[model samples]
Target: MVRILQGLAHKYFSDEEAIILLLLLVVGTGFIIFFGAMLAPAIASVIIAFILQGLVAKLRSLGVPEIVAILGVFLVFMGILVGFIFGLLPLIWTQVSALASEAPRIIRELQSYLELLPDQYPHLVSAEAVNTVYQQVSAEVGQITQWLVSFSLSSIPDLVALLIYVVLVPILVFFFLKDRRVLISSIGRLLPPQRPMMARIWHEVNLQCANYVRGKAVEILIVGSVTYVAFKLLGMPYAALLAMLVGLSVVIPYIGAAVVTIPVAVIGLFAFGWGTHFIWVMVAYGIIQALDGNVLVPILFSEVNNLHPVAIIVAVLFFGGIWGMWGVFFAIPLATMLKAVFAAWPVKTLERSPASEEE
Candidate 1:
């Protein structure tokens, strides 16, 4: 046991930097897990600042001065935030509330369809099975309604939090951008000076995460706008809400597309019925999804290189379960960071020779 412990110690604790890295990882993860909610605004600010750094770099590449580029990016961020708050959020909220209110009628329509299963396809589907499904659907609808009601009831507190986030995030983001070097230097001062592994991981993660976040933002806007336009042309009900779901669906892997499809199909069926219009609506939606997954995602996230789909999905589920929406949003980057760390971690290699074996 002493020999084994000695071997383990030699493998992991041979270097002071390794000890420091391990300590930092444990402490950082603990802070994130324990006080994440309390630090959400700050965390969110960091993410937003990272995203906007791409724009700053772009402006700098175009011969813009450093301060000018930062100012431009900051102004653009503020404009977008203001627009989202005043123009987009209210519309999305109204649509969401409307969707919740219409749930009962939608459930009724689904139940009505289920009722015909026994008569229409008696051999294929039994009344008992149909009724079972009907019960499940009804229960799900009730749960959804309950959640919406609870959410509405708590809107005041939520709004207050939102207001706080709105005021704090921008300030934090501005300072984060303006003093990026100073902040980085401050953080570095706390870490062991000789940290090749940590530095390598940080460099890779920073590059990948900045590209991923900025690309995701662009993808979301493009997808949402395109979907909204198409839905509007088709006269689809709740176009804005459905488009928003379609846009955000890009965050999760296959699961998001599958889940969002439920509402889109439901709304489409309710709006257009089983007609050519409904068929067209579905085709259009399918096209949007196909383009996003096959074309847009690849083009935008090419900088992410070769993240396995399974890894991405697992990250989405695991981190999302732990930290909810923020986790889901950062899942890919976090997974990438983990992968980089694992790759960068120094592993002890044993030289197996006759002399060593004899010893």
Candidate 2:
């Protein structure tokens, strides 16, 4: 086995030049991936600042003090956020409370459905087994609150990190917005002479992140509103909460829509007595999503990218596997950047353009 491995390694290195070239390419790709992940926070911050930086710069250019401009922008943004929270919180709270009260009934309905299945096929499952499972679930119910508290405690560090980000981002954002030219020039100085091309590529990638901020906010609100209204009309419990979840998840792209709908459909099944009515609600969700994907998103994010759906799926899974939920959240934007970069590459451009046009 060792001899065989040695022979393969020898052959691989026999062409030393090719081996070095391959290694360099591998290292370069790894560096780009690593750099992307590492700079996610700063990238997010910069994009956010860019949205308001134009206004800030305009104000300063027009004789407004930097402090006043910053304050005005911050206050305007905060007012928008506050208004949204104030409008949505009550409905969300009410639905969440209603869902908590209905949990036992939902569980009971599930138990009944399972028991009925066994009755329809006695050899498949016994009454004793069903009862045992129900009893086990009932026992676990008492531990739910304890588990939640423990989970919260375990996530203290993450909570702290989030708090740190909350505090730091605004400060970082202000400086970035105020001194954007200086910062960009400083970064350019750090790169090698030949790598100005790479720096420009990075800058272009940064510019594209605004697509996520602007596009996602609109998409999430629309999807969430549709979900809330759909659930409420269906008389599903926790309509507001479910809608919020569906809306939040919608930002994650393809899989998010399904994840948001399934539980709501299940709850609707129990609430509406398991019939065509329940099925109709699920079908409505599908229709709404289809419209959103085919009409709403395209209209809203027309220039976002035209990458294939399969590529989006691969990105979500590939990155999500590496970094968990955050990976999934960033996947689409990252994928969009990849699509834009490749499409804009010199070779692709030259191929598409006529020789006279290029010259």
Best by lDDT: 1
Model 1 earns a TM-score of 0.91
lDDT of 2 by residue, 182-260 (tens): 9989966654555433545465655565655567767888988887788778776777787788888866776787787
lDDT scores of the candidates, listed in order: 0.87, 0.71
Candidate of highest TM-score: 1
Residue 284 lDDT (model 2):
79
lDDT of 1 by residue, 1-359 (tens): 99888888777677677777788889998999999999999999998898899889899999999999999899999999999889988998898888889988988898899898899998999999998998998898789778888986768898899999999999999999999999999999988777787787778777777777788899889999999999999999889888989999887668889999988988999988999999999999999999998999899988775578899889988998999988997887788777766666766754578988899
Structural similarity to truth (TM-score) of each candidate: 0.91, 0.67
Worst 10 residues of 1 by lDDT: 342-351
Which lDDT value does model 1 have at 231?
Answer: 98
For candidate 1, the clash count comes to: 0
Q: List the residue pairs that clash in candidate 2.
A: none
The predictions' CA RMSDs to the true structure, in order, are 2.4, 8.2
Least accurate stretch of 10 residues (summed lDDT) in model 2? Answer: 343-352
